[model samples]
Target: MGTLVTGYVVLTAYLVEPDGPWDQQAVTNSKVAGAIGLVFSALMALLTMAFVRAGWLRKWWHAIPAALAITALLRLTLLAAEL
Candidate 1:
């Protein structure tokens, strides 16, 4: 779950062009990246829930990843608005 979240962060950092001019292609790329990030966040949430259910992780530990996923989704939403 951590790996998925980290990979999503890195992928967005690479794919999102916050400083660059928003060309048509760049907007398209950003949209695609946002969609992918949403999927990644969902997957992370599911995996975290699974871990808690399977007793591999404590209930309190679920908050960490849930917070990260929420933040990631918020960031992606803001980026999409910008594009």
Candidate 2:
């Protein structure tokens, strides 16, 4: 769930301005959105970790969502830098 949400947020940031209207302001807006998405992804990952520690998520594979969220956040960071 967290991975899906992070993917959607990152995709939205990527698709913000697909055309030639990518001015400085547009880039700044996209960066801001990406930053927010990164923060959200981080929080979701942390929450997933907490759940796992609390025994709510018993399986070892339950950590995969947090790992995927972190990966998405890393990619989003690179994308924001490129923007």
Candidate 3:
């Protein structure tokens, strides 16, 4: 889930709106959305693995939905901030 969402964001950022962080960005120096999304996904994968190894989760796959929710929350936050 996280991979899918982040992939979309990165694709959009790279192809649709290279100059913006989000779909509606005017302009900013923040890292490109694609890079940010990739970084977030990578970090989440590591964290998920850590959790799974710690006996906190049965499968790393289970982290996808949880990460999706968090990504959604961040998306909403960016949208609201844009407004």
Candidate 4:
């Protein structure tokens, strides 16, 4: 889920850049955002797995909302920036 969110955000940011602004800062921002998301997702996934193994969070459903929200926000933010 986190991987999906990070990929969506990174891909959208890349696609939009070619269609519009070609600024270095925009590229840097995208890279930074993607990197941060990747790191966060890695951490969260690890923690979630650990929790599940410990008999705490037993379902993947717990992470669904956050993943969906991140994906939606990534798309919206890209559209807004393009606009």
Whole-model lDDT per candidate? 0.62, 0.63, 0.53, 0.56
* Model 4: residue 79 alpha-carbon error in angstroms: 12
RMSD of 3: 9.3
RMSD of 4: 7.3
- On TM-score, the candidate that comes out on top is 1
Which numbered prediction scores highest in lDDT against the true structure? 2
Model 3, residue 23: C-alpha shift (Å): 12
User: Residue 53 lDDT in model 3?
Assistant: 90
Per-residue C-alpha lDDT of model 1 across residues 1-83, encoded as one tens digit per residue = 46565556636644666455556676566666656655666666688789889999888866655665565566556545353
Residue by residue across 1-83, what tens digits does model 3's lDDT show? Answer: 55676656644543432233454543221235645665757766777778789998779565674565455345434632231
Candidate 2 runs further than 4 Å off: 1-4, 58-77, 80-83
Q: Estimate each model's TM-score.
A: 0.62, 0.60, 0.41, 0.49
Poorly placed runs, candidate 3 (over 4 Å): 1-31, 60-83
lDDT per residue for candidate 2 within 1-83, as digits (tens), equals 76677667766666665335446666666666576667767777677778879888766745655555564465456555342
- lDDT tens digits, residues 15-56, model 4? 544335556665556556555654555566676777778888
For model 3, which pairs clash?
A: none
- Positional deviation of residue 25's Cα in model 4 after best superposition, in angstroms: 0.5
Q: Between the candidate structures 1 and 4, which one is better when assessed by lDDT?
A: 1
Rank candidates by lDDT, best first.
2, 1, 4, 3
